[model samples]
Target: MQETSVTKRFNELFDKLEHCDEDEQRQKIEEMNEMINEMDEEEFEYVFTTELFNKIHEMIEDKKISLENAILLLKYIGYYKVLKGIRINGFNESSLEEKFKEIIYDENEKKDEDKNEIIFVDICECYFMLNNQFSSDMYPICAPCLLNVASSKEKKEEAQKKVEVALLALSNSSTVNV
Candidate 1:
């Protein structure tokens, strides 16, 4: 049987993600984000189905991909879902939150000065994009993680961007009435 366009594109993206180095993974992620952004609402909803989210989530949980890349992929998906006004149907919000919390609360991951800054930035963006879906009660669990990233002095050049994303997550979380 021939592969469908969605399947083909998803496989291509995932293949690149699995095989690439850190910089190449980032490039592929950016490309994937652009492709998602260009999709119309119906198309986006169709392509990014519950099964797709589950597959990606499983990859993250199984440690098949780096946390940073997984979060970046989730961030873009959340952003496009919000932008397109698409209602999440079969996506598992609880599992996603659990994964986010695990990554955020992992002290060892934060202790890595070389990678923690970008990881936290991506986490904040993920939270911001999915703010409406997450409860305000979850904010406390995430705020301290963001604070740690914001205060890190090793990456002075990227500090502002990190701080901005952290603030964005906090602001969105605070304002969520749901």
Candidate 2:
């Protein structure tokens, strides 16, 4: 697909993200969010390219983006995915979930880990949105995260049904229980 103006602008933003400090990175990502927010349905095609996922993975690996900003970007990915009603068996672009799983599971292993309930919730929301329906190789990673948040007194309110379906899917899958 030809690169539209939006994609070109997003590319420029991604380049700037590399040289930016934490505060600057946040500002750039917020700008990105605004750009996406302004897009019409048809313009979404430009911003929703595979390159977006690729850049997100690169930025994450390079530590050029914080977890909060990473989550912000993923929200748009999931949002556009829903808008396009696109679902397929394999994403074939990036194993984005593995990176997040590492972050989350690492936190899970820490002593006195301040479980950022919003992180877990946002991740669960994105996981479901980015997957093929509720099924993906992400089940193992997302299942635990979702289950954990589902038990939270404050954070569980929105994810009740998601937690249930993840449980049902977990029982049916051969993925070893965590």
Candidate 3:
């Protein structure tokens, strides 16, 4: 998988760290090593992409990326694939089923806090849209979208920011909200 390249690159960086005694470099290497050791290729790719989406969303919110371009970026990343008519892979048919079940179970035992329904709705719509466009409808909106949507509204500066967050949330593979 492509993630192996990421791991290998990290290893090369770690080797180079030996030439320097900086605590920060060592700490970064240790963190990277730990992540590489703990996660498989699929998980690493999912997490990496999710983190990148969040960072990009942050840039958009900060006005580093224009709203029109942000929407364009969303299209480039496959958000509009549903409208284009793509099939989504079903969770039950994927290896992520067990992990999904575990996460749902944990969430079910937790208390619900008052949250913004609009953001949630937007996220759900975005998920469905993307699922129908890029993958298959069997794909459910995952946890990351739900969490990010709920949290992002707290700092929303414009309508476009909310939409961007919703798109970013849709891209994450963590949870699928029914």
Candidate 1 residue-wise lDDT, 13-65, digit = tens:
97667667777887888888777766666666566656666666777676666
Per-residue lDDT tens digits for candidate 3, residues 43-96, read 444433433444445544565544333333333333423322333343223322
Candidate 2 per-residue lDDT over residues 128-170, each given as its tens digit: 6554443344566666765665454544545565455344333
Q: How many backbone clashes does candidate 3 have?
A: 14
Error of 3 at 141 (Å): 7.4
Could you arrange the candidates by TM-score from highest to lowest? Answer: 1, 2, 3
Where model 3 places Cα greater than 4 Å from the true spot, the runs are 1-7, 11-97, 113-166, 171-178
Each candidate's clash count: 0, 0, 14
Ranking by lDDT: 1, 2, 3
What CA RMSD would candidate 2 show? 5.9
Please estimate how well model 1 matches the true structure, expressed as its whole-model Cα lDDT: 0.63
lDDT measured at residue 34 in model 1 versus the true structure, 0 to 100: 75
